[model samples]
Target: MSRRTRRHITPLITAAGAAGAVLLSATAATAHVRVIGDVIPGKPATLQFRVPSELAEATTVRITVEVPKDLMVTSVPKLDGWNQETLPGAGGKGTRLVWTAEQGHEIQPAQSETFRANVGPIPDRYSLTFNTEQTYSNGTAVAWNQPRTGAEEPEFPAPVLVVDPEAGPPPGSAGGAQQPGTSASAPAPSVDAATPQPAAAEDSDSDSSLPLVALIGAGAAVAAALAAAVLRRRGARDGSHL
Candidate 1:
């Protein structure tokens, strides 16, 4: 191929490769209602689920959120212009709270709604599905129960909130004992007393050799002084005899 043609095609190939990479990296991020704020175990926690109203052009007529049975949600606050229904699960153990958006509660285009509920003491981790039904003036019902999967786009996507298990106490505090740092009444670590050391004995065999070493040193010093005196006397006698 001619140099001019190769140069022209190189830029086009590079641009195409860069565009492909960007498109592959841009995976669809599905929109779903997420549970926000702290959920303490055995305590009531206020939860809010955000609902987008852009699913349909018509004003939303009714919005219903199905509370999962596993969460053990006991009660919901009453809101003006809104109706609530609690459906009992199997065996009538607990009721699932459902909120219905009444007439004039339609969320207009480019708007959103925040649903609030106080939930607590859930038995286990669970997920709640918010199924919203929007009815327009034309008698059409739009169900938002369709969930997004992979790259597929749903006409009306409902939001889902998952409740996770709450973290328990730290290690060694299991038996309801008062944990450390709570009160001075808790028991402290005990320390043992040190034992007394024995004194060295005077008649011990290890010390018996000390007196012999001193006697040997004294005898050697006396013998050295006597030898020196004898040598001096012999020198004086030899000089007088000569």
Candidate 2:
């Protein structure tokens, strides 16, 4: 490459690198806490909270999440280096599950933890949102309780689960599938498309209207012509008699 081109390319490369780094940092900041598995509605499912340590100077000491009243949450997975507990919420209905670092163990900078729990009778709803707080050893706590979707998401947006409900039973359970001799039932086809019963009624109505219209028009024309003929015949009889 020419010397001039090299000088211009050097600054462009530096600018691109800087932009990439900013984008990466933004992604990491927004994805600090998220759900790891599918959130099924109307059933108890295993869920995981993916937590990442963001502070470079301190370790993450504790994490708390507000479980919705609709979801029944009780058990937490036994992590080797973490302790879990639940506290009373503002209302008597829900729970605030807290997971703290065990003795001599903390989530260091650039580290992450996956805390699992079986939480639900998940309501049949569109989404599940959890408000969370991540506390650092330096007493800094970051709150993640913001709207899930918009033109611009929050710095630490609340983790949301878009519920997906399948009609069949949960997987891996016995007797959930069709019998060996039977075929799976297809959805009943729409009556209009499959049977075409309504078309007959519509056609009947249309045929009835066409005959009525033609009869009305023919009757009107015959009445008008008959009136003219009567007038002419009356005049001719009167002149012949005179």
Candidate 3:
């Protein structure tokens, strides 16, 4: 291959490689479900569903999420331009609530839409599936409708709170078993206030001495330089007189 041809193709190859790397990085960065906030078991917590409007664009007009059956969701706040449908489960219990936010309700491109659900007093750990349907202005629907299988990679992963059994006695409450001569409150450390805290004093003293030492060294250097200059001038004067 000619040097001229190689030089021309080098930059093109480099540019292509860089573009490929950037594309791969962007795909990897966006390839997971992002959950915001801690998912505490048995406690009321707010969860925000963040959808990337960049990839879905105008195509995603509506979003739907399947609430976990185990979690006791007391209320879902009304969102503008969105409709809620609670699907009844067996025995008059509704296990799933589907929230549909359509075209006009859809979040703008490069923007995030948040839906809040109040859930609490759950007995066990459960996974809530967010099954989303994005309908474009072109009558095309893209379903971001995949259930989180616990094993799935997350972008902003919701924390799973582990509820452990309460340990021992409550605060300030005494148990039946008590050792003799032992007080409920632990003894405070005995500090010798009378003892001369020489370490701190020495440190302060050293810090103060450092400046004085530096001043002395500087004065000595200045004195020595002046003495040398005076000697040089005296020798020059004596040589001129001679």
TM-score of every prediction relative to native: 0.42, 0.56, 0.42
User: What tens-digit string does per-residue lDDT give for candidate 2 at 158-231?
Assistant: 87766753543433222244545555566756867777588698999999899889999999999999999999
| Model number with the top lDDT | 2
List, residue by residue over 1-242, the lDDT tens digit for candidate 3: 23642233321112323322122236533643344546555567776666555442232354445555566667778888878665654465545555566547665555666667666764543334444443333333344544323334333333232333243333322322345666768875567575668798899888989988999999999999999999999999999998
At residue 112, what lDDT does model 3 achieve?
A: 61
Over 4 Å off in model 3, which ranges? Answer: 1-33, 56-59, 89-94, 126-133, 139-242
> Would you list the C-alpha lDDT of every candidate in the order shown?
0.52, 0.70, 0.51
TM-score of 2: 0.56
Clash counts for the predictions, in order: 0, 0, 3
Model 2 misplaced regions, further than 4 Å: 1-27, 165-242
After superposing candidate 1 on the true structure, give the runs of residues whose Cα lies further than 4 Å from its correct spot.
1-37, 89-96, 126-158, 165-242
Instruction: Give the candidate number with the greatest TM-score.
Output: 2
Q: Candidate 1: minimum summed lDDT over ten consecutive residues — where?
A: 20-29
- Ranking of models by lDDT: 2, 1, 3
